[model samples]
Structure formats: C-alpha cells, structure tokens
Target: MVRYAQTDETRPADCVIVLGAGTWEGEVSPVFAERLRHALDLYRSGLAPKIILTGGLDPRNTVTDAEAARRWVEAEGIPAQDVFMEEKSRYTHENFLYAGEIMAKEGWDDALVVSDPLHMKRAMLCARDFGVTAYSSPTPTSMYRSTGAKAKFLVRETGCMIVYGVWRLFGVRS
Candidate 1:
C-alpha cells in the first residue's frame, strides 16, 4: 500500500489519474488548470508513465471535463499518445471505478491520483476499494484561490463521502 504524504514524492507509478474539475464556457476553470498542472508536474517528475484524464460530458453542458483536460495537457506539450481519456464518468466514484477497470486491463498496480486537496481522502478511499495502491497529489492552493470557494468544495466533498458510505452500506452503486 502506498502511504499518503504531505508532499509529493515524484516516484514513478504505473499511471497517474487526473480527476476532472469544473469547466466554464468550453474553457477549463482555474481549478481545473490547477489539477492538470499537478498531473503534468507528476508526469514530468517521472511519478507516472501514463496520465489518465477522467470525466464525461454533462448532458446539459457542451464539453466534457476530460476532453478539456486533454486539450490543456496537449497544449502544454505532453504527447497525445501518452495521455489516456476516461470519458464516461460524471462523478468521483465512477471515476475511480472506471479508471480502475482500465488500470486492471493494463495491469497497473500503482497510481497517483491528482485532484483538489479537499477531495483527496475520498478519492483515495475509492481507489483503495478498487484494489490499487493510491496516493494523492493535491492541486496547489494558489491555483484554487478564494477561501469561500475552497470551503464550498470541502463541504461538497464531505457530503459526497457520506452519501457514498451510506450507499455502500446498503449495497447501492455509488
């Protein structure tokens, strides 16, 4: 099992999974950029051999968060071939489950998950449930900004965790 740490180690993994963030008007939000930046940093530092961008198009929204992440990563010069997309998940649970399936198919055992700091714990939980040894690489706070915004995100993440826990307890698909 991979141990969580306050700072990233830059140790290579089988893969690095970039969790999706909000997008606005076909553009990635600052938060989204922050998450992608962390994933890119991890990739460049040799923390992972491949990057998996995860998210799906919101039925009411035009662009999928995964697609936007891919575009930004490509613009940053990461080769298209090195970036993988999981575009069927709309939530964290689905993100881990779907990405885990892909990891299993590829025989990946270790992964570093990049996401907002507030969501790291739950994301790690989901990853562990999927049988992957996972660690967190939080997006920098400078990129997230605004205490109000971070607070809101933390609240939402906690709610998601609670809901997911109850669902699992009742044998419901999260």
Candidate 2:
C-alpha cells in the first residue's frame, strides 16, 4: 500500500491518463492544472506517445473537463491526435469505467494513471475493475500539500478505498 501510494512518475506506459479535477466556469482548476503539468512532463520525457483525459461536465461549469484538458494540452503543443478525450464520466469510478472502454476501443491496455497522490491506490483498483492495467503516477507538485489537507485526503481515501473494496466484493463493476 505504501508503495502504491507513492507516485511512480517515470513509469513508461502505453499512455498517460489524466484524471479530472474540478473546473471553475469552464477553466481548469489549479489542482487539475497541476495534474496536467505532471502529465505534460511525462509526455515531454517520451514516456508515452499519447495522453487520455477524462471527465464529464461538472455541475458548476459549462464545459466538460475533458474538453478543457484537450484545449490545454493542445495549447502545450501536443498534437490533437496524440490526446484522446473521454468526456462522459462524472466521478472517479466512472473515470476508469469509461476510460477502460476507450482503451479497449483504441487498443490501449496499459497506462500511467495521473491524479492526486492520495487517490492513486483506489484509482488503480478502479482501473482494474474496469479491465484496464494502470500504474500510479500521482502529481509530485500537487497543491494538496498542507499537512492537514493531506491528512484529510488520506482519510477520505481510506473510506473510498473500503467502499470500492466492498463494491468489488459484491461484483459491482461501476
């Protein structure tokens, strides 16, 4: 668990999967921006030839997170063809669920999953549930840096982890 919780940012996979964070008024939040920054670094390093961005339209925003991410990455000079967008997931569980389908359709089997540090474990587990092989690649420069915030995220992750375990135990796939 300890190792899984750590970010293996250098792992070379078929693609870099950037999980969505909240967007404010159609703009990527700082949290999501940091995630994209890490993924950009991963791409620039030649770790992967492609990136997959995921998220549906959040309640407070007019545009989908995936679309916003696509724009951002394109602005960064990553060609549109190298970046795939899945804009139908509204939660972490659906992120992997929808991404798995996209992966299968696109023939992407293994990926470096990018998200906040505390989210890697459960996200990886969810990735498995959806039939996708993924590695943890949490953002090293996440704004969730304060000790209290980290602790809170850890606790929340614990609950989410247990819930996902139960869901999997019961044969719930989504």
TM-score of each: 0.88, 0.92
What is each predicted model's overall lDDT from 0 to 1? 0.79, 0.86
**Strongest candidate by lDDT:** 2
Per-residue lDDT of model 2, residues 1-174, tens digit only: 446768574678889999999788878899999999999999989988899999999777899999998888888899988999989998788998888887888887799899987788788878877878888888888787789887887888888888878888898765
Show where candidate 2 strays beyond 4 Å. Answer: 1-3, 7-9
The digit string of per-residue lDDT tens for model 1 on 152-172 reads 766777788898788778865
Candidate topping TM-score: 2
What lDDT score is found at residue 49 in candidate 1? 78
> Would you list the clashing residue pairs of candidate 1?
none
User: What TM-score does candidate 2 get on C-alpha atoms?
Assistant: 0.92
Rate residue 172 of model 2 by lDDT: 77
